[model samples]
Target: MEATELNIRISFGRKHALALLSAFFLCWHPGFIGSETLQLTTFYPAPYGGYVSLLTTGGTNTVPANTILARNAGRVGVGTGTPDSKVDIRIPVGLGANGVQITDDNANPDTRSYATLGVTRAASGNNLAYIGLTKQGTYPWAIGVAGSNDLIMGASSAGNRTIPSPMFSIDTGGQIAMGGGAEAGRRLRVVGDLRVTGDIYVNGRIQGLCQRIGYSITGVTSCPWNHNVIGFLGDGVARVSGFLPASATTSGVGRFIVLGEDWGGTMICCRF
Candidate 1:
């Protein structure tokens, strides 16, 4: 065995760590194979703990072909020369595939802080797309995808722990639910009152009770009934109190009815 002293070195400098490892210095070990194979391990100390890199760079004076580095950011990078984030991986074109997949099985349960895939924009811009599996604690999911235009579907982020006020909901049956907490078996449910800015076109029979208030009703007991707004289907006995048909008991059969005061001071009731 030829004797040599190779500095299996480390950096204890301020925060600037740059490893200067030569190829021949690595294969100088006695148990190493031929000159065609090269392997080396380098460790660096940083302000936030340290970093370890295991690299395989072929023969003398050769650059590293593959690297597995674990850095201060709790990140592991494979095939990456310089990592900037967590789980940073880079592979050149014409190599293998470049993608990430995470699945949970019996042995691997989904029990972690926050796991997010941020698809950032070009020129080191902000995130354009994101998908995340969030838990809790110091690592909360930060989604800057589409610059605040991210569309999220389904269950709560904290596994029903912290519930978000329902914006909209859709089930597998192709039924769309708008507004807040969905009804048990309803296709559409709005937590609060629904207001329509445009016209409503109904395919079939539109069953609902519509009434306008804030005006004085000449015939009814309460002049200018100002309570009933707009809804779908209700049962009530409407008594006409004032005009031509005063004290007329109008039977409301839980159907669409538009009742309001006319501009000419007339009580109009249109039932359909």
Candidate 2:
């Protein structure tokens, strides 16, 4: 039951005032018990025009501390009912929001916006790779401080150094090595020539063959300019990828020579 307040100002004796007040209370709450009295504190209005209150039974009071003040305009304020941002947070999940954005607009140089995970192992676990980036499920780029990092495809070098070398690395030192499985020693060391098993898709021009020092492709395949054919035959297979005359292989997989007609003239070729 709601307790009603009466503005009674009596110019009578103190005992008379007490009697009148007690009588007034007894009339309102007939089962008036001992000691308990109505707590009459004025409910203050919130700074943003809403009523500040306590949530009783189901809640803390008429206005609870943890209560979220939201509006139909898709805005939510935490400490203050009036949120400045879309979902304004004064102190600090939600059923609905368009997209989540985390930003550090300070534009500082070395600020990390995303989460960072540092290596927690011992010195034996040194050179442990931290982050790896890839394309088509193959790791092509990586950033790790522990191990030797060398971009292995550009060249093959026999220079093998101690562990903890930079196999492929990128740092503020302005040092890069497109070398093989070892320390590049200096700033840049492209060990030797490159070899691949798949087709080389070149967006730009491909220069002539760069043979190894003191040697040439003529030592391997009679034709020095036969880099294309050399690459095709590097697998030790004699099978031609393009259409080859049946007569070419009909001689039963042994060294044989044959004649063929070409746009220029009749040509003779040897096959094995």
CA lDDT of every candidate? 0.40, 0.36
Tell how far residue 199 is off in model 2, in angstroms. Answer: 26
**Tens-place lDDT digits, model 2, residues 172-242:** 44455554333333554456666679987878654443433222232333324333222221323233233
In model 1, residue pairs whose N, Cα or C atoms come closer than 3 Å (at least 3 residues apart or on different chains), thus clashing, are 208-233, 215-224, 216-224, 217-223, 217-224, 219-241, 219-242, 240-247
- For model 1, residues 1-272, the per-residue Cα lDDT tens digits are 99998887865654343232444565467654543333443454545543344444342222333556665456766556467788776544432212332423323222443453322221112223333344433222423322223232322232212113334544454345565433456666556667799998878665444343232333343223433323222223353433433324654433444443242232323331
Worst 10 residues of 2 by lDDT: 154-163
Residue 133 accuracy (lDDT) in model 1: 49
Shift of residue 97 alpha carbon in model 1, Å:
12
Per-prediction tally of clashes: 8, 17
Question: Which candidate number maximizes TM-score?
Answer: 1
Q: Which stretches of candidate 2 lie over 4 Å from their true place?
A: 1-126, 135-140, 147-167, 170-175, 181-185, 194-272
